[model samples]
Target: MKILGIDPGLRVTGFGVIEKQGARLAYIASGTIRTPDGDLPQRLKSILSGVGEVIGTYRPDCAAIEKVFVNVNPQSTLLLGQARGAAICGLVQADLAVAEYTALQVKKAVVGHGKAHKQQVQDMVQRLLSLSGLPGTDAADALGVAICHAHSGDALKALQAFAPALGGKGLRMRGGRLVG
Candidate 1:
C-alpha cells in the first residue's frame, strides 16, 4: 500500500510518501512545500495547491495527516487548524481516504515514545525507511505519520472505504476486535 503523509503548516507544509509491503516500509519521496512570506489566504492557497499536486503526482492509495495540536497561543492553534483544513480538502478532492493521528501517536509509533525529540524522530524515520541521510524536521514528521498509519493496520480498510465512499464510517472496534 502506498500512503501519503502530511504535516501541514502555514509557512511550510511537509509531505512524505511510502510503500508498505508486508512488514517493511519503502520510502518513495519526501519534501517540503515552502510558501513565501504572504497573507493568510495566499498561504492557505499555496498549501491546498501544493498538497493537491503531491496527491496527483504520487497517486497514493490513501493519506494520513498529523492532527493540529493546540498551542499555548490559541491564535497559533487556529492558524494551524486552517492549514490542516486545506490539506484535508486536497485529499478529499482527490477522492482519497484520510486518517488523522496526533503528534504523540506519531512519535510513539516511530520512536517508541510519545515525547521523543525532533532529532529522535528524524533518526528513527531514516532507520525505518533505510535512508542514508536524515530527513528534514517537517518531512520527517510527515513520514512519521505515514509510518504510524502503516503500522496501524488500516491501509486496506482505508482503501476499501474509498470505493464505498465510507471514509471513516466503516471501521470500529470493540473488545480487541474489529466491530464494523
Candidate 2:
C-alpha cells in the first residue's frame, strides 16, 4: 500500500509518501509545499494545487493527515483548519481514502512517547525511513503521521485475522477469562 501523509499549514505544508508491504515500509518521497504569506485564498489555492500534483505523481492508495491542535491563538488555529480542509478535499478528489491522526498519537507512534521532542521524532523518522539526513521539521512531522498510520493499519490487520477465533464480539476470553 502506498500512503501519502500531510502536515498542513497556511505557509508551509509538508508531505511524505511511503509504500508498505506486509511488515515492511519504505519511504518514497517527501518535501514541503511553500506558499508566500500574502493572501489567504491564494495560499489555500496553492496548497490544493500542490497537493493535487503530489497525488497525481504518487497515486497513493490512501492519505493520512495530522489533525490541527491549537495551542495559543484561535485565529491561527482557524487558518490551519482551513488549510487542512483544503488538503483533505484535494486527496478526496483524487479518490484516495483519507485518515486523520492527532499530533500526540503521531508522536507516540513514531517516538514511543506522546510528549517526545521534535528532534527525537525527526531522528526516528530518519532512522525508520533509512534517510541519510533529517527532513525539515514540518516534513518530519508529516512522515511521523504516515508512520503512525502504517503501524495502526498493521495492528488492525493482525487483530482482524484473530478476531473471529476470539469471539463473535471480536473480543472474548478463551480459556476461562473475558477478553475485550
Candidate 3:
C-alpha cells in the first residue's frame, strides 16, 4: 500500500510518500510546497493545488494528515485549521480515505515519546527510511505521519482479523480505534 502523508501550513506544506510491502516500509518521495508571500486566499489556494498535485503524482492508496494543534492565539489556531482544511479538501477531491493524527500521536508513533523534539523526529525518520541525509523539519514531520499510518494500518489489520473471534460483538474500528 502506498500512503501519502501531509503536514499543512499556510506558508509551507510538506508531503511524503511511502510504500508498505508486507511488514516493511520504503520511502518514495518527500518535498515541501512553498506558497508565495501574498494574501491569505492565494496562500490557501496554493495549499489546495499543491496537495492535489502530490496526490495526482503519487497516486497513493490513502492519505494521512496532521491534525491542527491549538495555538495560544485563537487567530493563529484558526489559520492553521484553514490550511489543514484545504489540504484535506485536496485529498477528498481525489476520492481518497483520509486519516487525521494529532501531533502527540505522531510523535509517539515515530519517536516513542510525545515530547520528542524536532531533531529527534528528523533523526528517527532518517533511520527508519534509511535516508542518507536528514529531511527538513516539515518534511520529517510529513514522513513521520506516513510512518505512523503504516504502523497503525498493521495494527488495524490485525484487529480486523481477530474481530470475528470476539463473538460478533459489533466491534468496529474508525480512525484507528476500536468501537462497539
Candidate 4:
C-alpha cells in the first residue's frame, strides 16, 4: 500500500509518500510546500493546489494527516485548522480516504515516546525508512504521520473486521480494545 502523509501549516506544509510491503516501509518522496507571504486566501490556494499536485503525482492508495492541536493563541490554532481543511479538501477531491493522527500519537509511533523532540523523530524516521540523511522537521513529521498509519492501520482494520461479530455479542471497541 502507498500512503501519503501531510503536516499542514499555514506557512509551510510538509508532505511525504511511502510504500508499505508486508512488514517493511520504503520512502518514495518528502518535501515542504512553502506558501509565499501575502493574503491568507492566496496562501490557502497554494496549499490546496500543492496538495492536489502531490496526490496527482503520487496517486497514493490513502492519506494520513496530522491533526491540528489547540495552540496557546486561538488565532494561530484557527489558521492551522484552515490549512488542514485545505489539505483535506484536496485529498477528498481526489477520492482518497484520509486518516487523522494527533502529534502525540505520531510521536509515539515514530519515536516510541510521546515526548520525543523533533530531532529524535527525524532520526527515527531516517532509521526506519533507511534514508541516507535526516529529513527536515516538517517533512519528518509528515513521514512520521505516515509511519504511524502504516503501523496502526492494519490493527485498526483487524479490529474493525471483528466489529460485526463483537456486535453480535453486544461488544465493541473502545480505547483500542474490545469492550461491552
Candidate 5:
C-alpha cells in the first residue's frame, strides 16, 4: 500500500510518501509545501493546490494527516486547522481515504514514547525508513504520521483476527473494534 502523510501548517506543510510491502516500508518521496507570507485565504489556496498536485502525481492509496493540537497560540492553531482541512479536502477530491493521527500517537509510534523529543522522533524515523540521513524536521514529522497509521492499521487487523476468539465481532471491527 502506498500512503501519503501530511503535517499541515499554514506556512509550511510537509508531505511524505511511503510504500508498504509485507513487513517493510520504503520511502518514495518527501518535501515541504511552502506558502508565501500573505493573506490567509491565498495561502490556504496555495496549500490546497500544492497538495492536490502531489495527490495527482503520486496517486497514493491513502493519506494520513496529523490531527490538530491546540498549542500555545489559538490563532496559529486555527490556521493549522484550516490547513489540515484543505489537505483533507485535496485528498478527498483525489478519491483517497484519509486517516488522522494525533501528535502524541505519531511520536509514540515512531519513537516509542509519546513525549519523545523532536530530534528523537526524527532520528527514529530515519532509522525506521533506513535513510542515510535525517529528513527535514517537517518531512520527518509527516513520515511519522504515516508510520503511525501503518502501525495502527496493523494493530487493528490483528485485533480483528482475534476478536471472535475473544467473544467480540467476527472478522471485522466496528467503531474501531470488533463486537460479537
Candidate 6:
C-alpha cells in the first residue's frame, strides 16, 4: 500500500510518501511546504493546495496526518488546527481515507518511546525506511505519522478478520479495546 503522511503547520507543512509491502516500508518522497508571511486565509490556501499537489503526485492509497496538540498559547493551537483542517480537506477531497495520530503515538510507533526527541525520530525513521539520510524534523514527524498508521493498519486488519467471530459472541472492539 502507498501511504502519504502530513505534518501540518501554519508556516511550514511537511509531507512524506511511503510504499508498504507487507512487513517492509520504502520511502518514496519527503518535503516541506513553506508559506509566505501574509494573511491567515492565504496561508491556509497554500497548505490546501500544497497538500493537494502532493497527493496528486504521490497518489497514495491512504493517508495519515499528525493531530494538532494543544499548545501553551491557545492562539497557536487554534492556528495549528486550522492548518490540519486544510490538509484533511485536501485528503477528503481526493476521496482518501485519512487516519490521524498524535505526536506521542507517532513517536512511540517510530522510535519505540513517546519521549523520543526529534533526532531520535529522524534516526529511527531513516532506519525504518532505510533512507540514505535523515529527513528534516517536520518531514520526519510526518513520516512517523505514516509509520504509525502502517503499524496500526495491520492490527486493524487482524481485528477485522476476527470481526465475524466476535460479532457472534456479542463482542466488539471499541476504541481499540474489546467490549461486550
Top candidate (TM-score): 3
The clash numbers for all candidates, in the given order, read 0, 1, 0, 0, 3, 0
- The digit string of per-residue lDDT tens for model 2 on 34-109 reads 9877888999999999999999998899999999998599999999999999899899999888888899999999
For model 3, residues 1-180, the per-residue Cα lDDT tens digits are 999999999888999999999988999999998989988999999999999999889999999999999899999899989999999999999999999899999999999999999999999999999999999999999999999999987877777777678766545666666875
- Best candidate according to lDDT: 4
Q: Model 1, residue 44: displacement in angstroms?
A: 0.6
Q: Which ten residues in a row have the lowest lDDT in candidate 1?
A: 171-180
CA lDDT of 95 in candidate 6?
A: 97
In angstroms, the error of model 5 at 151 is 1.0
Per-prediction TM-score to the true structure, in the order listed: 0.87, 0.91, 0.95, 0.90, 0.94, 0.92
User: With candidate 3 superimposed using the best TM-score fit, by how many Å does residue 93's alpha carbon deviate from the native?
Assistant: 0.7
lDDT digits (tens) for residues 1-180 of candidate 1: 999999999889999999999888999999999887979998889999999899889999999999998899999999999999999999999999998889999999999999999999999999999999999999999999999989887554655466446445565545535545
- Can you tell me which runs of candidate 2 are displaced by over 4 Å? 169-180
Error of 5 at 58 (Å): 1.5
Segments of candidate 5 deviating more than 4 angstroms: 171-180
The list of candidate 4 runs beyond 4 A from truth reads: 158-180
Error of 6 at 168 (Å): 4.5
- Global CA lDDT of candidate 2, please? 0.89
* Per-residue C-alpha lDDT of model 6 across residues 114-175, encoded as one tens digit per residue: 99999999999999999999899999988989899999888767766776776644444567
User: How much lDDT does candidate 5 score?
Assistant: 0.89
Off by over 4 Å in 1: 154-180
Candidate 4 residue pairs that clash: none
Q: Indicate the TM-score of model 3.
A: 0.95
Minimal lDDT window, size 10, model 5: 170-179
